[model samples]
Target: MPGVMDIKRKIKSVKNTQKITKAMKMVSAARMRKAEDAMKNARSYANKIYELVGNMADRVEADSHPFLTARKEVRNVCLAIITSDKGLCGAFNSNVVKKTLAFARENKGVNIKLICIGKKAYDFLGKKEFEVLSKYVSFGGKITYDEASEIGDKLVDYYMSEDVDEIYIIHNEFRSTAFQVAKVTKVLPLSIEKTEAAETTDYIYEPKAEVLLKEIMPRYINFTVYFSLLESIAGEHGSRMVAMDNAARNAGEVINKLTLTFNKARQGAITNEILDIVNGAEALNG
Candidate 1:
């Protein structure tokens, strides 16, 4: 049984914690709205770019470009992992890391290259057994297309150099505030269907279709990376908002329980004091 003083102190502490969690929940909720809007806006452009690139790739011979060429065995594979820099977002980062690790484990014999986006991912995968090629940390819980472009540039350079035979991006796709989908996308050797879809469309080229492809293909890759980053940002904010909301609710419940305990303890103390006074008065009078 806790003393009245101790119970009061605990109740006060829990109330303070509840206030903080409530504020955090509100802040994350506001940010989530903006993040989600940004993601939705970018998706249309990303889809357009992919559709155009896929169509263009069809007009030319599949062997016309190295990027469109698919190889039999993947000697080296690069995994671009997007994660949050901070914790307290429930299991957002942990789940992504888990899925990534599972993929890495599944491809045991192949050389696994890592391109980590967040500090958490960099730290988590940077240790032994993983080859971290590049990392970009400190996006400040938000990221922009420019930051995404820099990462895309690094991946393009690596892919063109044939350093990695296959490139895959691992990220969380925003479904709703409560849900996110873990996704792994193949970045290179643009899908055959996308190319065929492009081939069927008829259009007049200004200079040449191949020339346009030279310019557009790289941009397409960049846009794909950028979109993935945006999706990741949206997912992070959504997850954080949901996590903080739960935290606030849990804090409220705790504070309520503690207050109940404090009141009981105080009532017990008062009852004991009254009993002591009555007993003393009776003994003195008798």
Candidate 2:
């Protein structure tokens, strides 16, 4: 049995922890709402841009641009992994890391180059023997379009340089406040499926098809990267918010249980002292 002082100290510690968890839960919930709104507003424009680009690609010959070309032998692959910078989110980082490892395993022998966008992914993959080509972890809690553009520029450079045969983005797409789906979307060599999404009847080019293709092609890739980052941000916030809520609830439970234990211990001590006093008094009377 712990001394009364020890029991009291434990209860005080638990109370402090509970307060912190509750505060964190509130903060996360507020951030999650803002993130969700940003994602929703950005998604439509992002989708329409890609769809328009795809439809234009459909009308033109496949070999009009090099980015549209799909290679037969995939020797080198670039994986752009998106994860949260910090963790407190339950299983958010783990899910992405596990899927990425599985992807690496499945695509054995192909030279895998990693492009990590978050600190969590960078740290997790850095520990492994994988080849990490580039890492961008500067994005704070808020992800801006500039950050996305910078990341996209690297992918474009890699693809244009022929350093990587295929580029894929693996991220958790924001589904709901409590749900996220891990998705791997091919971002380079501009898949025909993407072109199919934007299929249109006829289109007029401001300049020659070649010139327009050159201009629009890179933007399409940049926008895709941007969209992914935005989605990932929303998903991260949602996961964190839910995780914090759970943590706060669990902390409350712990405090409740500890308080009960403290009370029991204190009561036991008091009862023993009373018994001792009573026994002494009886002895004196005897």
Candidate 3:
């Protein structure tokens, strides 16, 4: 059993840790709210852009643009993986890394290259045998659309140059403050699925459908990347908030146990002193 001083030290340490965790939980909660709102606002625009592209593909020929055409054989694949720059979150980064590795393992024959977006992804994948084509880290919690556009442009260049046959992105999709799921989405060679509910009315193109496609398709790809980044950021905050909340609770439990132990130790010390005094007094009197 530890002495009263040792137990007091432990209690103080735990109380300090509890304070830090509580502060972190509050900060993460505030950030999560802002991130969720940003994510919600961007989601509608991203979906509309996707819908517009799908509808346009239906009206145009298959070979209207290079992005609209699918490759006959997939030879090489590129994965743009998004993870948090920092981690205090439970399994948020680990889950994404595991999913990406599983994806790589599942597609053994194809050549896989990585475009890592966060420090976590870059650090984990960098140590592996996988080829990392590009890495971006420490965006300082603020990712701009222009930065996303740069990444998207690089992917487009890779596709156009025949460097990669397919491009996919892996990220954490924000569902709620308490829930997030790892999602993998293909962004290249643009999959066009016809929607039954979409209107069949004919529409006129201003600069011709082909010309407009050349202009807008790249924008669509950029927006997709940007939206994914936003979603991942939101998910990161949510995960961290939950993690810190749990940590604070655990710290509180530890403090309670330590306080109880301290009281017991102090009581035992007092009882021992009293017994020693009584024994000495009885011996002197005898």
Candidate 4:
């Protein structure tokens, strides 16, 4: 068994750790609220644009947009994996990396490349078999639409130039503070669809549907990239908040246990001292 002093030191160390965890939890909580609000607001715009683009794309000819044209063979593929730059966020980054690796394994023969959005993703996947075309990081746990658009421009260029036959974005979609699901979205060779309302509604475009789509398609691409990045930021904050909360609670539990041990050790030392004093007195009297 450890001595009383050692146990006391352990308890003090745990308490210090608990303080850090609590601070991190509080910071993550505050950031989560802002990130979630931004993500939620963007979701509305994302939904609206998705619907608007789908309806417009359906009315236009396939030849009108390169996005509408499907590649004959998907030889080269690009996977854009979004994650947090830092750790201590539970499995948020790992899950996304796992999803990306799974995708690579499933498609064995295809030439796969990478576009990593965070340091974690690049740090992990950069050493892997896939070629990392680009990496963007160091946002300090905060992200903006302008940054997303800049990345989007890179993706647009890659797709338009036929550098990659298909493009997918892997990320964690925020469900709740405690839950996040990794998702892979195929963004290139755009999958245009007709909404339920579009199937029946007959309307004419202000200019021309094809002309409108020509302008709107690129925006849709940018929005998709931006929204995914927002989702990742929100999810990162939520995951980190939960992880830090758990860490703080565990630290408290450890401190409680250590205190108990320290008290027991101190009590044992006191009992031993009393016994020693009584025995010495008896010997002296004898």
Q: Which candidate achieves the best TM-score against the true structure?
A: 3
Candidate-wise lDDT, in order: 0.83, 0.85, 0.91, 0.88
Q: Candidate 2 versus the native: TM-score? A: 0.94
Question: Candidate 4 residues 1-286, lDDT tens each?
Answer: 8988888888888899999989999999999899889988888898899887777666667778888888999999999999999999999999999999899999998999999999999999999878989999898888778888889889989998889999999999888888999999999888876444546575777787777777887888888998888888889989999999999999989988888888888899999999999999999999
lDDT of 1 at 199: 32
Q: Weakest 10 consecutive residues, lDDT, candidate 4?
A: 193-202
lDDT of 3 by residue, 101-132 (tens): 99999999999999999999998988999899
Model 3 TM-score is 0.97
Which is better, 3 or 4, measured by lDDT? 3
Top lDDT model: 3
- Per-residue lDDT of candidate 1, residues 149-168 (tens digit): 78888888998898999999
Q: Comparing candidate 3 with candidate 4, which one achieves the higher TM-score?
A: 3
Model 2 per-residue lDDT tens digits across residues 102-156: 9999999899999998999999998898889999896877877787888898999
Q: Give the TM-score of candidate 1.
A: 0.95
Cα RMSD of all models vs. native, in order, equals 1.7, 1.9, 1.3, 1.5
In model 4, what lDDT does residue 197 have? 59
User: Once model 2 is optimally superposed onto the true structure by TM-score, how far is the C-alpha of residue 172 displaced, in angstroms?
Assistant: 0.8
Model 1 segments beyond 4 Å from truth?
Answer: 194-201
